[model samples]
Target: MSKANAHVVWHPTTVTKADRQRQNGHKSCILWFTGLSGAGKSTLANAVDQQLHERGLKSYVLDGDNIRHGLNRGLGFSTADRKENIRRIAEVAKLFVDAGVIVLTAFISPFREDRELARGLVEPDEFVEIYVKCPLEECERRDPKGLYRKARSGEIAEFTGITSPYEEPLSPELIVESGTQSVEESVQIVLRYLEERGIIPARR
Candidate 1:
């Protein structure tokens, strides 16, 4: 059992999430982009974030390597560490949502249970799980980070698609075929989804 931190007390904010959302002029959500290393998850996420920013919407992206270099430093690629890594990211994303900003996360996030844990932290409609689907061969061929080479050569262990596993989402909110669709098309598809779902104002 875990010991409770009695020194830590709950502090309620006068300005609630609803108030922040009202001020931002739109609802907040988490656009979770999960896929293989070179599956264009980061590319698609950044593209979508750019459009949202251009539309004057509050948005931010939590990238994998960036987070590891900072907030998630010292976390390894073991099963438990990976779970902890995801847990920490999810908590941060939840906080961003509370602050009325759409948080787009681009991570391998190969496990469905970890994604579900994040999803459970928010409202049903607030978590948009976007599966950036691409075949393993294509991802390896287009390995932007050279991660595939490292993983294939045994330089990196517990890699998602090579050494480890990648369990696809059973029913994700959106599935962008990175292997088939262009980045611009994927961005438009996500924007259209936000509009159709009334998360943001429709384009005039």
Candidate 2:
């Protein structure tokens, strides 16, 4: 190991994750929403967050565009940058899990390998991969940000589903049909899964 790295040591938190979970009355995990641009990942994630907030559950969403404006501002849309972006977000999500908060992350996360690495950062049950399934044509049709148009005009470089690639999840824990389902429907599906898995309590 490098001398600089050898000097760094791990420090445990005073309050444990279980302690926080017990006090919060819900288990902590990351709801990883992955899909192509304009596939409704951000919409679903925020909608679910609102539901959890209304239920007084400890939950938060780390959105792609919002996060890029802050934590990942300097990162660009390149293969290596995308990989690093996912890595940094995964580490942040791990910290959230340790704090016993149900965190939701909505990102394109185009590479399966990078998503797998993110999943590996937490426990088996802690990583809930939700694939927002929508066809390329549908995504282009619903291009809310005009990203598809820009990408097609060569104004954007290495954009997923355009110049770049998006590797779909082989077996996600849940698949939300974003093209056909309304935002409310998609939110319920995610919330139902959390309740079924005992991560969050069922509606009383």
Candidate 3:
């Protein structure tokens, strides 16, 4: 171990994750939402979080732009920076899972290696990859933040799905067709999956 690591030791929490899950009446997991820009990842993640909250379930959303303004403010859009950003978010999500909170992260990520790295941090069933599938043409047309326009006009560098590439998840836990489906329909798809997986109780 490195000198810095040798002194650091693992500390166990007195109140275990299972204890918190029992109290919260739901399982804790990470709902990782990956897609290109303008793919509605943040919108869907927030919608899911709201639904979980209304159901008295512990849940929170870690959005890309919001997080960039704070925890990852110093990072840029470079390839290395993007990887680091996802790494940090993954670590934070794992902590939330340990605290028995269902954490949803909305990010482009754009790399299979990075996504798999995030998955490896938790148990097999603890991480759910939700691919927000939308065509490049649709995303550019939508351009909610005008990012695609900027990228197309050469105002931005190394942007995913324009200058850089967005690697789609090969076999995601769920695939939300954001391009074709209504927002409410997409939200229901996610909720149904959670219920079927025993992460949340089914509605009466």
Candidate 4:
């Protein structure tokens, strides 16, 4: 990660992204899922990932907790750490896109500036910002991870949507109400969007 090295060279691959896309029979893009915890971001992301896999499309899901287990392990929950976490995630997601895989990222990613930083890394159309719309009270009600409970108890600090804030997307490309709809319905909505946008071929 040190850019200070003078001998580093950018190596261009012979097989370009376009070639990879043609071989895979679909274009690659980033499906960025952002919401409060317990809002079904991970669930809906994996659901869509499963649907894509069933259709023989190359896709991957980068969940926040999972990523933190390795790639982002040392990072903490502070504001500076959160920004670094998102920056690294965006870079990695960009690599996945370049490799011709539709990468679904499920992260709270509460800051609009951070989200926009990710969006700016890719072609405008290749970045799909999915705002998983669910009220804070509803998310707290679900509390699948018990994070909200801990936050309320002062056991955890800087927790998004509780002690900290979640900046909702001002103009997300897609909005899915995971609070009300079934996961199946949400998956269908995403698939349809990809097809409609010509990111993937129509259903056969």
Candidate 5:
């Protein structure tokens, strides 16, 4: 790396919250949903984004599979690739937050260390980790994309909770039990959290 590139100074600009709020009409945050495969992270994230849209909130979802087809195309399932994947996604999410938009990220994020690193890249209170808690058996039963089946059949390598590991969040901001809870109920839980935190206004 060039010394000039490494030694660039950051002259902070005075961009007030009022200015951003006026442009986007709300505060920005990162809603990071983490879990194993087939744990309904993507499903819940999309549902929550739809609810936010209906309530006039500016939000977007950075889904794992979708990202793999584009920004993270070169990444694979290795630990190093997974860390890099989350790092890139965190940077993107930070940009959205700066633009005053709520960014929802749904990824396996199997390692707690990687998740914590992502959180460290953003400002304090800007990231909210939501743990989608579902048992491995239940996740296999649901198997919306049949990924679990492939993992079990030895067709896939380094699958979380089977061939690899899944590190549960020690103190997630929110936990949704997707195995027992209905999708509607899960969405309501997330919405209620956002409303309670004043991220979204309460209904009149």
Candidate 6:
């Protein structure tokens, strides 16, 4: 370590705390949902968001397809692009958290390093990782978007669980078994976890 390499810098900004609080009206956090495609990650995330909304909590969802259409439109399914995509989304999620809005992100992600990097970008309690666990066969059977079929049929390349790989989380904050559990059960589990953590008030 060399002090000569370090430089002090300051950037001026004028945004008051009250202003941000009034704009979002709730504490901000990042709920990172990871799993195989067709594992019900998006479904569970959206359902949890709906429950939070009913409780007057402010939240937004960052989904895979939705982001690819905009912020990550230029990115592809390559390993490098996938990492970059998660990096960009993580940065955006950090911004949303600072703005006091709960951000629910649903992505395969498929790499522990990228997920860890995303977690490192935010404060300790601000990031929550939910593992939507589902067997490969079950995911293929569900095929919510027909991606599994396409990947198997060569219509898609380097798809996770097909030509590529999906690295499961070693230790996730929460686990939702989409294959064996009902959607409502999964939603309730997530809601309970959030409530226990005081992210949201206990349901009435």
TM-score of 3: 0.92
**Model 4 quality (TM-score):** 0.93
Model 4 regions more than 4 Å off: 1-13
Q: Write the per-residue lDDT of candidate 6 for residues 77-176, one digit (tens) a residue.
A: 7778888999999999998887778889999989999999999999898899999999999999989899989999999978899888898999999998
lDDT digits (tens) for residues 82-150 of candidate 4: 999999999999999999999999999999999999999999989999999999999999999899999
Model 2 residue runs over 4 Å out of place are 1-13
RMSD (Cα, Å) for all candidates, in order, is 4.7, 4.6, 4.4, 4.2, 4.6, 5.3
lDDT of 5 by residue, 1-204 (tens): 344564667644668655785776677889999998889999999999998899888999999666989999988867788889999998999888887889999999988898898798778778899999999998888888888899889999878999988999999999999989998999999888887887778766
Which residue pairs clash in candidate 4? none
lDDT of 3 by residue, 103-179 (tens): 99999989999999999999999999999999999999999999999998999977899888888999999999999
Q: What total of clashing residue pairs does each candidate reach?
A: 0, 0, 0, 0, 0, 0
For model 1, how does the per-residue alpha-carbon lDDT over 1-204 read when each residue is reduced to its tens digit? 223656657554479999999998889999999998899988899899999999999999999757989999999877899999999999999999999999999999999999999999999999999999999999999989898999999998778889889999999999999999999999999999999998888989
lDDT of each: 0.92, 0.92, 0.93, 0.92, 0.88, 0.88
* Residue 79 accuracy (lDDT) in model 3: 73
Model 3: runs farther than 4 Å from truth?
Answer: 1-13
Evaluated against the true structure, the overall lDDT of model 5 is 0.88
The CA-based lDDT of model 6 is what?
0.88
Candidate 3 Cα lDDT to native? 0.93
